[model samples]
Target: MGNEETPESRERTDRTGWRGLLVDVTPLRTSPSFAKLWTGTSVAQIGAQITIVAVGLHVYDLTGSTLAVAFVALWALGPMILAGFVGGALADMFDRRTVALVTATVAWLSIGTMTLIAFLNVTQTWPYYVLAAINAASATILGATRGAILPRLLPTQLLPAAAALSGITMGLAITVGPAVAGVLVATVGFPWTYLLDAVLFAGAFLGILSLPPMTPEGGSASPGFSSVVESMRFLRNAPNVRATFIFDLIAMIFGTPRVVFPAAGALILGGGPVTVGVLTASFAAGALLSSLVSGPLGRVRRQGRAVTLAIAVFGLFTALFGVVLLVTGMMVGSAGPEGVNVPAVVLAGIALAGTGAADNVSAVFRTTILQAAAPDDVRGRMQGLFYVVVAGGPRIGDLLAGAVATAIALWAPALIGGLIIVALMLVLLRIARGFQHYDAFMPTP
Candidate 1:
């Protein structure tokens, strides 16, 4: 060929052999805007994870109860959900770039505040809770807006690839973030970790500011209660869309076990901050691995079936993770502050990784289905609903995980919740034929 490189040539050069299974970067190569956004967001995701894990560590230090730590996220849940709805309206009404930037600014400022508080060594817990809620709410708003912005930036054929790419960034971020946060906080203290997060947030600001204005054609309606209502009405008409949200909620609320990781480290796993970091990173690693080899995702047309099966796999693995915990504890017993249980930690990490991979696989299909099905005019609102499902579902899961762990055992909530997720998803899939047989190539709401 001439000096130019075609898509096929690039694929050949990138693949060479078995490495071809990794995440596709065609969207990043083709769309400069998308590329910039992805780069900036990925950097910021690592920072955000640092701050998140740090805050959890700080809260656990102050309260010494897993429920208290869970409540930290619980307090942020309602406001963040509302913010998601309002942000969706704003995205539809204004230049989506501006909306995204405004939210990112709010989150950045919140991080700054947290940094200051950490530096001061504040003993109070409520103020940190407030700041965390504010930060989470802002992030929720950004999530809805940024998700809506994606479809506008890339072609429809590349949407699946785009979602997989996102999974990669998120996977890497979560993997690096907690691991770094654990080490940094343990070594340098909370103030320094929070400061690093604040510093890293600049990348997000640059990314959103660099984006071109994204306003719908024909001048969309103003942001208001009516806009929210309009979105709700649309959802009423769309059963497949409704099913996706419900299924995700079921999975998160029932199967999520993150709220207990810190306690697991302290009480059962015995590696402390390092253990917490490794566990958190293990989940992200699973998700990352799945995204890395998601080349086949773009071709699958039965997206609904794919989503259901993937989520089912997630539940199974989650349950297995709980079993790992129970079995390990029964065999060797938990360790003390100076002790370690390497085998238990390794098995648990593998189980959590499986959970992450299955969840991302489901997410890839779910995202493609949502991006493909929703019309452009109402994409923001639709994305807002999605953000609610995403951000809010975890909070509910945290509450359930915390409560169940408190009542029974640290591992009981995961086992019970995972079983519930599997049963509920199976039932929902059977009855909701619209969601069960959804075809991607010929998509419908």
Candidate 2:
């Protein structure tokens, strides 16, 4: 072989060349405080997912209408949007840890109340909607506060890895949580499921309690209506941040296909409630797998490009989901009001899994960009906007998907929505070359 390296040697050298991929999770693993927070949040998230599944089932069992279950999000959307902006301001003005703690406590109480009402056989629709709205509003505040606190817990270089880990946690919660909820509702009943969620929510306290006091990063902004408006003005001047939010909104609004899931499960797929759980879990499954195998994600220099590409892939997969639905529909002829008999459910689940994986990759990059780029003083406000996009966009998608499915065929909404996402993303990417070439080594706002 003389002085030439053998193929095996070259392969080994190449494999080790991208060492940045091996994200040192030591900070998270070693920091007792962060570890407690992670553990508590993980448990709580699973609980929250369980409640989500339970609430949907409860509503559907009571009304037998997908629209009613969908309306739960609709009812919560206004409050959630308002809270996201206001909560962001709160995170900036107050101690983030305390804010998170209080909100989490309130949220837990809301669930506790829900469980109580459910056990009493209070089948009123208004109570469910009202309690769910309260729970959602509190969760929004907690989400914003927790997001702002993340940068403080770890080094800037590790933010992407942290984001990836968060995705994994979310994936785990949704993947296992809903399935567990289905079984619990089937066996132990909704009251017990809600009670379990209430109990599990106490775990969030553990996470919040472990954190040292984290004061606002910059001088506290006055907390009021103007503060929210001023934050909006600040974002208008910040083109890069604005672009990030805009792109995220577009991706979420057009690409999210979750609303049509129930109909898909019942009609296009033969497996009813079990199918619904599988379809939802499949999305999380893709996300979980992506995060687990994301060793190469940390090595990426152009995070913005990675984000754009990931979102684009997300749209493509969403389109594939629609196509699968369309094909199955064609194969099984319309069953009118009765429902179709086809094998599209499994195929749709697979497509959703792909979409979830792609979205997780985008989430990792987008969150890192926001945390790394925004000034600490304004990080809270920016994170608030991030929350709005993250929380609000999906609600909008739910409305859009629900309305479109009702007006047209169930599959038509996903088919058209997915195409819109792809087209819009391509145009946005072309216009924002700076975003495409954004290097993580030298951060920019």
By lDDT, who's the top model here?
1
Alpha-carbon runs more than 4 Å astray in model 2: 1-24, 60-68, 266-269, 335-344, 406-408
What TM-score would every model get versus the actual structure? Answer: 0.87, 0.88
lDDT of 1 at 250: 84
Model 1: clashing residue pairs? 22-292
- Model 2: per-residue Cα lDDT at residue 48: 93
For every candidate, C-alpha RMSD to the true structure in Å: 4.2, 6.2
RMSD of candidate 1 to the truth, in angstroms, is 4.2
For candidate 2, list the clashing residue pairs, or say none.
Answer: none
